[model samples]
Target: MAGQPTYMLGNRNKSSRTRDAQSINILAGKAVAKAVRTTLGPKGMDKMLVDSLGDIVITNDGATILREMDIEHPAAKMVVEVAKTQDDEVGDGTTTAAVLTGELLAKAEELIEKGVHPTIIASGYRMAAEKATEILKTITIDISRDDRKTMGKLVKTSLTGKGAGEYKDFFADLVIDAVLSVAEETEDGIQVDVGDVTIEKREGGSVLDTELVPGLIVDKERVRPNMPKKVENAKIMLASFGIEFHKIEKSAEIKITSPDQMQMFVDQEERMVKEMVDKIIASGANVVFCQKAIDDLAQYYLEKAGIYACRRIKKSDLQKLAKATGATLFQDVTDIRPEDLGSAELVEERDISGAKMTFLTGCKEEKTASLILHGSTTHIVDSLKSALNDALCVIGVALEDQKIVAGGGSPEIELALRLSEYAATLKGREQLAVSKFAEALEIIPQTLAENAGLDPIDKIIELRSQHEKGNKNAGLDVYTGKIVNMLENNVLEPLRIKTQALNAATEATVMILRIDDVVAAGSRKGAMPPGMPQPDMEM
Candidate 1:
């Protein structure tokens, strides 16, 4: 017993393992939050995220910023997911979700410090979130989808902080028209699909040149120079397969015995191409948009037929064209019929930015729409594209839900005020956690004020007072540095943005709080989370 040496299992001990993983997770969440917090409000700053490869991104969009940075911390990536979820689900409010989650974690960190368990804090925060959403439903106003003026305001609000702020009026009008063009009235409610709206960016024009096309556009030209540049009352044939020989599926060698046989083989291939073109012509399709290439011989025949054809069209473009023109996508040229052709008043190939692009216009009944975005610099165009996309998604959601809420941080203030009242009704430490959740909600308005260079505390006090008086619409008017009614001022957002942001932020915060350890894959060295100490390093 005295001579035996002790053995170690995996060279691990409780002291060697990372302690305070939950604390580290919360800090990482907060760090990610602070990184994007300044980009929250209309006056928020843009983040210049440079990746490991030295690629640069200058953006105020939260989801874009988080995505661009090379994040390594597992908990930090969870924070990033908050942004992605908010962006994917609501199209706006990624910054709000990230900031709220960070603030929630910060507040919960304090509750943990006070000896309250993480689960208790999570449940309390959950309760506060539910209460906040209920208050939101009460305060939101019904927005009639047919009311263009009000709907335009909803879009303008979305575009306010983005680089497109200067062109809000023009862009808002364009966005609403695009949304309404694609929206359909169903038996249950109005349904909108954002994919129905396509955005095309081109240089050499100002933002003012941006216009809405009622149909679709593809950045492709007529396959041959001899093809007609324009076709009137076009009967369109959309094909997913190439028009040449219909595709053989496999390659083979055709050996010729003599010059005469080679000539015959060539003639046979030409005749086959001619027959395929004849079939399309018999179907009465004067225009063709092929998702695949058109053979040179087939293009020649198509040109001879005076057909306007665009080859190598994207699958998405083909589908939208079908929707816009009532076109049927053909896999077989043999089954062509007049009934399969889609009608567009005009199919024209136009030179845009030195490239040939085709436009299918005059389909007034079709639900597909296109937005042509123009700007002098790629940066401005890229930023405008993002803003316009957000604007469209927000309006679409608003129209679908038939409900809207005041933006400019008014809703958060109202939710905070209501949540605080709800928190007061609870007993014990859970009440404190709920109250902390309410305060976390206030971070939105505070950030709005801070980003505007206004006094955050004064803004919060004024907003809280206004909310107390049943003026639920009262919110920080960052542009004016005053407390005003967001609805009266025409600053509005979709109700889902606020509700979804809170839902995502709370879920993420709770998830981070619930984690007690993080074991990385192939972790060879004893793990020590950032800000936690290693015994050897301390020595």
Candidate 2:
């Protein structure tokens, strides 16, 4: 009994050690990758994801699809994280990252079955990722922030293969203008905050009616109907304080012996509200954006003063207002001064569709821009928003980095070709991993061809021939099933998108490959605990 080895784990715990664990994890990672594989390229299809509550999201965006899925497998979730990272870093190429990750795992599975250690495969992947990144730098073409035509091409490339592709030229110009409006030239480089470009959507109009506003649009209206709907030469006061009488912070009880005391208290409250409103008026701010509530008494005073005010504004919108109008946000009404006000040429409340919204245009600094997207239905608007977001992000990345690359799967095919050649110079099994990495990249073009109803095998063969002939920019033209120079076709994207996707995919694959054990504690749903005896119901 003493020599007997004790089980280190509790009976409730379940574990899969070594090869079994690796197989399970690899399978899970591959499965997640496969889920979004078909959603790649210009001819890709969309996925309609419906949650338990019956709400639906339809999109071909890889990150959206993965985010909407209720994935439970731990390894699969890691793969999903790859897509998320790609989205956050570049806002596009999520599907390529996911599909490449899956292919890497699928190829690694072959090596694993052939007795190659997981560690060897992982080391190979690391080396291959580094080499691929180096290769990307060589192929990237220099871009300038002032080159609106190329930037628009990059935006259009991103918007393609989705719902907004039909209006890509329109959306592309809108996105480029929106991004550049918020862009500031810093000592480091041209800095762009995509957040400064607000996208507002309204249903009932055609998509062609979408227009960019040179200022900010707040989805709120003036607090009082009698208030002036429009203010010219708007001096805006952004306030975080409520224009209401202060409420008791803690529980309190006051005994009133007569109606005179109650009347006096009411008068005091009115005076307090009036004083707060007076502070706003003294600041010479004709338009007010408050982060908190406005009392009815205060509203009456503000309306009487001919001030257009909106109450209970979102903190984010208030911040944008400060940037757009060159104003300071005041935490206390007493602290407000004329110098703290932000100026706008015009502030007007307009009825968009059936809802009232405030539009602040011709701001003093013009540091923010807004796109009012129009569509006939909720779904179309949502899809358009997604597409435009990707476009804006890529354009921003291109401006900041000042580097662009040909799209339409051109980069992937070229990277695969060069990586294969580089793999040949590497020693030992790492070459296999590097070569496999190259092969994995071809999946992008293959999937593109497949989605477009072309023969993937033949297309890849033709693409390889073109690359072999030194056509580095050659990519699949999905519509015509021809291998064309993407650069000549004006299919372009930011270099950041390709580099980010490669890094995310390779890192995720390497992390998954290094796992050789999985110890799952607690019984899974509908599954029995380990070492538990089965119930005999046949008796």
Q: In TM-score terms, which candidate is top?
A: 2
Model 2: lDDT of residue 70: 87
Go through the candidates in order and give the C-alpha RMSD of each one to the true structure.
4.2, 3.6
User: Looking at candidate 2, what is the lDDT of residue 349?
Assistant: 93
Residue-wise C-alpha lDDT for candidate 1, range 47-144, written one tens digit per residue: 77677787666789999999887787778999999999988888999999999999999999998888899999999988988888888899888987
Worst 10 residues of 2 by lDDT: 530-539
Model 2 residue runs over 4 Å out of place are 1-7, 523-539
Clashing pairs in 2: none
The Cα error of candidate 1 at residue 376, in Å, is 0.7
Q: Model 2 has how many clashing residue pairs?
A: 0
